[model samples]
Target chain A: MSDQQQSGGAAVASSPPVGETLMEVTGVSKVFGGLVAVNDVNFIVPRKAIVSLIGPNGAGKTTFFNCLTGLYRPTTGRVNFDGTDITAKRPDIVTQAGIARTFQNIKLFRTMTATENVEVGMHPRLRSRVTGMILRTPFVRREEKAARERAREILSSVGLKRMDELAMNLPYGDQRRLEIARALASEPKLLLLDEPTAGMNPQESEELRTLMERLRTEQDISILLIEHDMKVVMNVSDHITVLDHGEKIAEGSPQEVRQNPRVIEAYLGSQA
Target chain B: MRFLASLRSGRDTVTGMIPGWVLAVVLIVFAVIFPYLVGSGSFLDASTQTLAYVIMALGLNIVVGFAGLLDLGYVAFYAIGAFVIGWFGSQQFPDVNGGKGIHILASDRATFQPKLSGGRLDIAGIHINFFIVLFIAMAITALWGVLLGAPTLRLRGDYLAIVTLAFGEIVPRVFENSTSGLFGIGSTDFSHGRQGITPIDKINLPWSHDLLYSDANLKPAYWVALGMVFFTIFVNRRLRDSRLGRAWIAVREDEVAAASMGINLVRTKLWAYAIGAAFGGFAGVFLGTYNNTVNVDQFEFGFSVFILAMVIVGGMGNIWGVIVGAVALSMMNRYGLPQLNSLSEPLGFDVTSISFGIFGFFLLIMMVLRPEGLIPSGRRRLELREAEIEGSEDTGAVGDMSQMYEVRQ
Candidate 1:
């Protein structure tokens, strides 16, 4: 597809507004044993934009996400989110710093109801103390009610309005959507979706694409997504970063990266 | 149509409410009527003893069930609570000033004397009220829990279990050995030793004015213990439903996931240990008062293992399961084995052999057949069944659920 068509016919009449800079990773390096899982990576993600990080298998896309999200601290370099140094912060701290994420594998509290699962995401947001909870005080009751309402809204937005259903009972596509809804319930300034459309049909992927577009425009939140499907990535992403063997090979608009010979070679060689 | 639909949705919203409310009412009712049904006096005694175990089990549940922390030294807290109370409530120096007593509670009276007879010591000078001693015992035991919990929370699984077991063994030994020289009440030669602190003053009530020392009965003690148990159940239920409780369960289910969500691992784990230890402390006070004696033998490793077994056999992570386990196991230890021994004695079988043999056999059967315990936690039961079914289905190929999902995909 041409660069103009790939922009989804929403190309800026005036230049796409330079939104806030939400995440800035500067020269991050992560070495495991003798091998570099992530080598000297540098990137910037702007607020309210869907930025896609795509690479062939073993490209360290997931590793880089892990470092950024505080699961694995980078051996070198710094990660700044909203003016705070979050490089060595624990995952919970990183999450509390306004970044929420979904795993490549669904990690919903499987036994918990869909609503309860979403409520867990709203854990940091809830303002009930242990003492208040034990006493079942008025404040706790009110806070619980508010949390349930917020959970319901998030679930309904993701098209799983029946919140009483167990998370594992949801079909694959809805589960994926529920995961997104959960991430959103954390009320994060940035949402990291790892293979958000993985294991979904074309129709589901198409719906997710529209959802991404709507979330970007209306939710006032940035998205950093790792997706294997080129069609979905190219369709939704305003910009794309390509990685190969733990190295950032190219980064630009989707059209530019797709046209890059090195990016093409990386995929072709991996397939062979 | 929207109104009717909304009303139906509202009804569904309160789905978890009915059972919870019903259970609460039933428990409250049982607590009120149980004393009378069990013949106020004898039933009270048994119930008081049960209450002590209930509290201890609740505490242990937080560690083993909520946080998945296995502690085999929980009885240490019990020892600390009882000893602290024993030290203060009883006068140890009767012959200190040539037949004049030095009482721990008050040393105002000159005619007060400490009485010692038949290897048991009694303080005739000053006696602290039972309720006051119970509170003091709980505080002392909780401090011990923190002391033990701080160093061991860093250790995981079997290592943690072993360290706690050693601590449990050492605390009572120290208490039994160290009460003589520094205290000046008992000489180095005159240690409480293995026989333990005896002639502990029975619990007295202001209401039972003339009947104060009539009999070491369990009625009043039972009421106090019942109050504490209900209080524990209420507190634990709230903790389970709160953010901290959810964090604890998350850690138990998946520590990595829990940490990823920003839960401070050390803080969460410490809280579990502290809360669990606190319960053990409460139980210690009740136990000391129930027997009217504080003995080192009572808080042994066997008792710790018994409490752990109760948590496991009842159901880990489930409150009701812990209660059921505590009551069931307590009955087995206190009543069932003794009854069996009496019956087997006439049938030409040794009491110890028959009792232990039956106990060991029952435990073995339980492990092999129902590893998840009688009322296994919902998640545990599901995982166990899923694993078993999966294992049986794949006799030739050993592959897990993730691999199966991959193959199907």
Candidate 2:
């Protein structure tokens, strides 16, 4: 989106100087039948920042996320990630290219254990083809051992010490964290958490916010969170973008977005 | 009863005091000498055939159970493999060797010898050894697997099953119809019409006489087939733990999510098909050698269904389940039908003629009584249990069934 205080017919606020853009979305629009779900939205996520996307329900926040992640090809514009024009790339290719994501609904492999889910995320990093697997070659064995060790490390770090418990059997809060841990296993340059703390307790949400901050600093991974909880969003995000009716309405630092009238007007209208 | 219990709990008996591997070693020793213990060549022959079926069923399980792809035409691979042996091992094409039979791999192979005539029988062209033909069968079948897997990449569930079924039907028909070359391309006869390529060069070692002609010494075939079963089990176990195996399960669980995890759907599915087909070829080559023929009649839609039934009746993803299913179904097909004949003989009906119908009944019972099969994987078992709970109409029937587990209180 534009860095200007008021540009693209939407209210905006300037943030501090940001790094090289990791993701630059330029004039992206996604249309479904007759509805413009994501209507010409320009968005940017700078390197190593926790960005929150806040909008009312049906504001096409998820649709925009899908576009960036390559689930839905942007019908009209380009998405560039790490200098690669990744517009309309396949979802798996997007993952392989190091943009990992967790679904809003917690898409952990239900029957598989938490560790197994995380191991799946590690698939892109690990390379053991069928021949090596069948032969149990030394390199394959070493890779497997290292992968399992990495899984144990990731699981414990995410506070999921019981790696054997099935993802579905894990508690709701743990399951959400497990999903994050699974995404983290991919070693992505950017992670998109789609309302991860939804249906979580206040303490759980606070814990997730802390985890998000830690992930950004420790792993050098950028975070793009979609959240309704203003407390977590305002406290955790370096930048916040507000959307209304499939269009960008406000963009700024937390303080600047908090003072932006357009954002408040959109939320109030939706709530009313 | 005490004796049976003592035998059952080997760990409790004097033998039970031994370590697990010791017990396994003892079992291996027993298996090695099993043919001599039985002393019946016909029984050993039947057992060897069962082993071949077991291998085929295990292969089909990789696709259907592990990958969650319904394959109705797995027998096409079997046909391809058998044909590989038929083309490579037998004297089907006399033009290849200038009308002289050539022995390959087996230095002692009686060239074109259909019977123990104590002399090399002059027959058609190429009479390659069985060992070389076996690998060729596997390679060709694996290639067919990729071809079959490619078209079904976009297909799912019933559509996938239908496409596979069409393939299964087509392969056999092509073999049956092609009395000449493939679509009449050449003058070479591939299968020799309905007569089939006869007396498929017996499995002769460079060191020993051909097993088929070695005075009913079926031991070699038994040991070899058992070795194959063990090989299959080892490969299947390795695959189940590997990255590809995980991808198979992931794709089975949620294709979109798997794709998002960077597991290429086509690659994962193709591996399943290729691996499964390779084994089918392995068994096909074995069966062709053992049966002494690879007729188009043997490679039918019914055989595909039979193997699929074994996978389903055995628990789908569970390796042991499929083995048990394959062995159980195959043995039943071989031995059980004949036993039914004595019972049906009094009623003046030929049970032998209706043996297939009996198999259909067994399948029907299996589906209704245990949809999850004999030894279901942990995930499938739980999913089935949940579905049962939600559907509660079966609760009453399940309760009645559960009472069977209650002791003689």
Candidate 3:
């Protein structure tokens, strides 16, 4: 395993950095009794770059994302985002600091329309006061118009323009796209997509891969993705971080990490 | 030509316009001319009282309907509002110096005194005009709403419901027991327990002074209540389309998701509770003046349940639904039962309680048949159907559901 890692490790040494340093996690660890979920993990993701965190089951990819997103306080680590320490901030506070994320399970307001769902994401940006809202003053009306326009644009960008329909009525693929559009509506500099292509068909996965690339290139939004699909991750990710047993075992370009024996064993059986 | 063109275009859509504006105009005109056409003063008076309830239901709709909060103790705010007017407007507060000083100045020339008379405490001082008391009552009630909302905003669902219920219960008891040394006021014989404060100041206007039925005139109070109903409707419509309204709906739909979107859940919830409570308070004050009395029994749990039923039956989260529900329910409670009893007597049956029993049965059927009410909010109707479809479609997909949960877990 060590020999296979050293052979593939040299190829990743000189890859170009596409994204800006949007998030830097240093010495992060999480322990529950005798089990360590995430152990001394260190990583850096650049702005406008599509990065993937891949690993086998119980590899702590979700836990690390949770800690960074402020869903859970890290046992020990400092997570700095855009040069601000946001390790212990609440999820809402973290979102206000220009970071947004989608959950592994879609957590959309299922009862609301797709447009309304997108409009909710724009809540922090709207400036109408309660009195103004209740009174339906010019300020509130103007803000509403602007927010609706923005939501429309976001929905279009995610290829969901025709689906002004209620969120629950959307087909599965469209629902996933709506979720991304909703997250994008928050106007985050960094977007964390956890298992974006978890249950999609191959065609849907391919479409998502293309969408991820386009978002990084056009929207100028950095992405930190957690994916189990090796093909999609290999194709879309500019850089890859491989985790096994709650620790980063390999980190580099797609070609380099692909041939690493430790990564192979983590995915395939040891005998193979 | 333009009108004809627009009419043609309107007919092309599946969801055609129902000419709601014209309907509203007709309703308003009828409401204005009803008392004269009806000819019976008692019937007119009950009609006006029913309108007040309609306004209150609309206010409650914003909180329970739009925000999806189950507030079981909404009557507390109403009680506070009524008592504010009763205590101040009637000059009923006893003098502080062992009943020897002038505690309040009255609008009319009435002598001051404090004594136990006819199983009640008699306190005499300056009584304020009903209108002034009404304004003060609304303001005080709004303030009390803020007080209740401040501590309980973080609670959600059943917990919030329970806390609000307790607050509602506590408020009336606090007022009823104010003069019983429970609040450390030294048993000054004011707010005499359970019996409640009586001789509440009658609401009157200057123009009605020379008119017949002038003193304790129900018409003046009717107009005021009508004005409030319009004002409430106007405010509620504005709020529903505002950013705050969106925040409330967002919180209602998904608090965690709303918060993640940078909506402050605490603030949004508090605003909904406070605004709703303020309306309840205003209604309470108006009710106090209308009856010319205030009693602990008047703002009981039953009233709260009645208001809840009004909101529920009208349609949770729909403004128009609440108005319709309120008016219909009020009419049923006030007039429907009596009419039913009259009809029953002619048929040789004792059916005095038939109307309420029928109402309860209708509610039970509605809960099973259309949980969203007769006219549910657009969002509610859509979600309910979606849930039904999903439930039927996923009968054998339990494994998939568990798998999704596992992935989420």
Candidate 4:
């Protein structure tokens, strides 16, 4: 753990320049039949920045996240990731092009071990096909071994200790961490986490916040988060975008968004 | 229920006491010497057939068990496999080369087409080596599996099963009706109608001077079947641990998450079908040669269900479990049912006649009692039991609403 911390700290100086755009979302909207879930929302995540997408219930935070991840094709807009026009591309293609996401509902492979889940996230990065796998060629074996090692490293980096435990069998907090670990295994340029600390206690959420920062500083990866916990959003997010009823109500630093009258009204209602 | 629980615990203890590799080694050793141990030729033949079923079950396990794709038409691959051997290893096409025949690496015994005026053996029909034909069967069946699986890529669960079931039902009929021609495309006799293809060449190696084995000696056949089983087990084990295997399991667990992880759903599912079908074909060739016929009557819906039962009973996704399931169910079908026929006088009905009924009942009981299967893989066992133990607390719902709404007292 200390070794990982040291490596993480060492890479801080090498992290990408702040304010450089990593992912650009322009005029993105997702409509489910008659209901407009996300409406003309333009968003951006700067390089090595921790950006949070925050909103109340039914605020279209997840819907916009889905559009960005390619899980839901946007009714209108373009999502350029690291200068690649990845709008409407398949989710796998999106992951391959260096964007990995976690589900709001914790969609880890329930039966697979923590390590196995991470290895699967490394699918796009893996080159071993059927013949190589069946043959267990030297190269494939090496690749598999390296993958297992890397998976272990990623798991530990996310503070998950049990590598062999099934994802479903893990504690709720651990399962959430495992999801992050899985997303990290893809080595994505941008990591999109949906409700990373949904069911966590304050302590667990704090640890996740730290992990998110460490991921940005140490790994030089941009983070796009959909978080319900305001404390976490305020403490960790480099920038915060507030949405309400399928529209972007406010976007700025945590303090700016917190003071914005529209954002305040959207949360506590018009009276407040 | 208590007795069953205790029995399961005891079984687990016994199995867990020995290391897995030791058990595997012992089982393989027993399989290798099985032919010598069994005195009766018919028993040996049945064992060989059982081995063939093992291959088919393992194959089906790849699709239904590993990938979680319910393929009800696995017998289609079996039919294709059997016909591959039937076409390549038999005189099904006597009209090939104007009755002079085409022979490739086939022994003289296999090429009894016609005797020329100079007393030379004039080979007739396509006679490829058994090994080559086995590979051909695998390739063709894999292609067919992909073709059959392509249309069902967008389907899931019952809908997918229904389409596969339709496929399983259609393939045999096509082969059966193609005796005069393939869908009236040509006058080529495909299956020889309901009569099926017969007199398939005996197992002969390209390098061998004579036939490797004949009807009189069943030992060689048993050994060959055992060899094929080993090959299947090896491939299955390797695949279960590899990159592709993980992708299949991930897809099975959750398609959306798997896709999000960058696992290609189309290629992964299709490979499951192809590889699974390839194994079916792998065993089909052996069964065709051993049974001495490629009959459409054998490729029934019940057969697909029978293979599926093996995968389910053995524990879907567990290689050893599926093998055990195949052996138990296959042997019961061959020997146990016939033995039960003696009690038919008292029972007032033939037991063999209601074999599927009995299987269905057994499956019903198994699902209720031990849905994870007889020898479920570690992960699968956990998944089923976990679902039972943990209800909906993971769904973000409060487990204790009373605490959340406690009175001000």
Which candidate number would show the highest lDDT if scored against the true structure?
Answer: 4
Q: Give the root-mean-square deviation of each candidate in angstroms.
A: 8.5, 7.2, 6.6, 8.1
Single out the weakest 10-residue window by summed lDDT for candidate 1 chain B: B400-409
Q: Candidate 3: count the clashes.
A: 10
Strongest candidate by TM-score: 4
Residue pairs with clashing backbones, model 1: A92-B262
By lDDT: ranked, best first: 4, 2, 3, 1
User: Could you tell me which 10 consecutive residues in candidate 4 chain B have the lowest summed lDDT?
Assistant: B400-409
Query: Which 10-residue window of candidate 2 chain B scores lowest in summed lDDT?
Result: B400-409
Q: Arrange candidates by DockQ, highest first: which order?
A: 3, 4, 2, 1
DockQ (Cα-based) for each candidate: 0.24, 0.34, 0.44, 0.39
* Model 3 per-residue lDDT tens digits across residues B152-246: 77565689889989988998888887875646757555576788877665554533322223334456556677888888888888888777777
Q: Model 4: which docking level applies?
A: acceptable
Clashing pairs in 2: A1-A42, B10-B16, B11-B16, B94-B125
**Candidate 1 lDDT over residue span A1-272, tens digit each:** 23522342343221222467889899898887898888887888898888989998889998898889877778899999999999868787888899988878777766667887778778777777766887989999888888888889998887786689877677888888888888888888888999989999999999889988888888888999999999999999988887777877778888777877667877886344
For model 3, the stretches where C-alpha displacement exceeds 4 angstroms are A1-20, A27-40, A199-204, B1-17, B94-135, B150-157, B180-190, B204-217, B338-360, B391-409
lDDT of candidate 1 over B25-73, digit per residue (tens): 8878988777767865654666668778988898899888888888988
Per-residue lDDT over B1-409 for candidate 2, one digit per residue giving the tens place of the 0 to 100 score: 4753454366347545778778768867976788888875778888888889989999999998889999989889888888888887877887776676566654335454546445554565676777778778888899899998898887776788899999999998889877878877986788887777777777776566544344357788898888888898889989999888888888887666676677677788998999899999999998887788889899878889899889988889998789889988888888888898898888999887876677688789877777788767888776677566767755654464343112110
lDDT of 3 by residue, A1-272 (tens): 44644554553353434545888889898776788888887899988888889999889998888788776678898999999999867777788888888877676888778988889888877888877776777887888999999899889888886557878778878888888988888889888998988778999999888888888888898999999998999999889998877877788789878987767877996884
lDDT-wise, the better of 1 and 4 is 4
Colliding pairs, model 4: B101-B124, B314-B321
What TM-score against the true fold does each predicted structure earn?
0.82, 0.89, 0.83, 0.92
